[model samples]
Target: MGDTRWLSAEEMRAWNAFLAASALLNRQLEQQLKDDSGLSHPQYEILVRLSAAPDGELRMTELANGLINSKSGLTYQVTQLEKAGLVRRRTCPTDVRGVYAVLTDAGRRRLEEAAPGHVAAVRAHLIDVLTPEQITAVADGLGEVTARLRALGR
Candidate 1:
C-alpha cells in the first residue's frame, strides 16, 4: 500500500483561503439576515428552497437532502420554524408516513425582505472585490469541485 500524501504549501494556502472565505461569507450573510429579517442563515436557506419548490412544499426527507442535513436535525429546525409561523408540517396525501414542510406566507415575505440585503452583502464582501478574470476563475474552479463531489455520491 502507498503512504498518504499531504497538501503542499500552495495547496494549503488555497484550502485555508477557501475555508476562511466560506466561513466569513456565511457569517456575514447570517448576520445580515438576522439583523434585517430575524431569520438565521440555515432557516433562510430552508425557506428559500421551499419557496422555490412546486406548491411551496417539500417532503421533510427531500428538504433534509436539499439542506444537506440529517433528518433529525432538519426536523428540529422545521419544528422551530413552525413555531415561528414561518412554516407548517403536513402529512403527505399519498404516503401516510411522509411529512411535508410547507412554507408559509410569512416565510415568503421574510425571505423577500432578506434577499436584497443578503445579495448586497455578498456583492460588497466578495464579488465586488474580485476582478472579472478572478470571478471567472472562481466560478470554474468551484464548478469543477461541485461536479467532483456530486460524482462521489453516485
Candidate 2:
C-alpha cells in the first residue's frame, strides 16, 4: 500500500463546502427547470445541446458524450423526449448503425419558453451572488478540474 495522505483541515473544509454547494445548486436548478418546463436538468441540457447543433440534430453517441451520459441513459431520455414530441430519432444516412436525435419544432418552442426563466434562476441563485472576479475564478478553477478529469477519462 502507498503512504496514506489525508486532506488537511482547510482542504477538508473546502472540499465539503464544494460538495454541499454543488448538490444544492443542482437541486435548485433541477427544481426550477421542472417547475418552469416540466423538464429535468438533464433533459433541459439535452435539448439545449441539440438546439445548438447543426439542423438541430446530433448523433446519439455525440449527444451522450456532450452530456457525459451513458448510451442507455441517453436512449431513455431521448425516448421520453420523443414521446413528448420534443425530439425525433433518425437513422444516420452515411452510417446505418448510427442514430441521430433531432429537436422538433415543439422542442424549440419549449426551450425558448423555458430559457428566460432558466437564465433568471441561474442569475438569481449563482451569478448575482458572486462578484465578477469570483465568478471568473470559479469558472477557471472548475475548467481546470474538468480538463484534468477528462484527461483521466473520468
Candidate 3:
C-alpha cells in the first residue's frame, strides 16, 4: 500500500457527513420516485435524459454516456422501458452500425407526470432547506467536480 496520510478530525467529520448526506438524499429520491411514479431513480434519470434529447431520441452510446452507464446496462434498462411501452429502440438509419433509444409519447407523458412530484421532493428535501447562495455554492462545487471527472476521460 502507498503511504497514507491520516485525516484530521475535522476532515474525517466532513467526509463522513458528506457520505451520509449523499446516501440519505439518494435514498429519499429513490423512494419518492418509486412511490410517485413506479420508477426507480435511475429509470427517471434515463427518461429525463431522453426527453431532453433532440426528437426525444439519442444514440445508445450517447445515452449511456449521459447516464454514466455501461452499454449492456443501458440495453437492459431500455429493454425494461420498451416492455413498459415507454421507449423503443430503433436502428440508426444513417449510422447503420448503431441503435437509438427513442422516448415514446407515453414516456414523455410519464416524465411530465413524474417531474412535478420529483421536483417537489427535491425542494422539500434539499432546495427548500438551503438559501439561494448555498444552492449556488453547491451547484458550482459539484459542477467543478463533474468537469474534472470529464476531463480525466480525455
Per-model TM-score on C-alpha atoms: 0.90, 0.95, 0.91
lDDT of 2 by residue, 109-149 (tens): 99999999999999998999999999999999999998898
Q: Sorted by lDDT, highest first, which candidate order results?
A: 2, 3, 1
Candidate 3 local lDDT, residue 69: 88
Better of 1 and 3 by TM-score: 3
- Report the C-alpha lDDT of model 1 over 1-154, residue by residue, as the tens digit: 2686888999999999999999999988889989998888889889999999999999999898888788998988898899999999999888999999999999898889988988898899999999999999999999999889868973
Report, for all candidates in order, the number of backbone clashes.
0, 0, 0
Report the Cα lDDT for candidate 3.
Answer: 0.92
* Rank list by TM-score: 2, 3, 1
Global lDDT of each candidate: 0.91, 0.94, 0.92
Lowest-sum lDDT 10-residue window in model 1:
145-154
User: Better model by lDDT, 1 or 2?
Assistant: 2
Superposed model 2: Cα runs more than 4 Å off: none
Best by lDDT: 2
Query: 2 or 3, which is superior by TM-score?
Result: 2
Candidate 3: which pairs clash? Answer: none
Model 3: what TM-score?
0.91
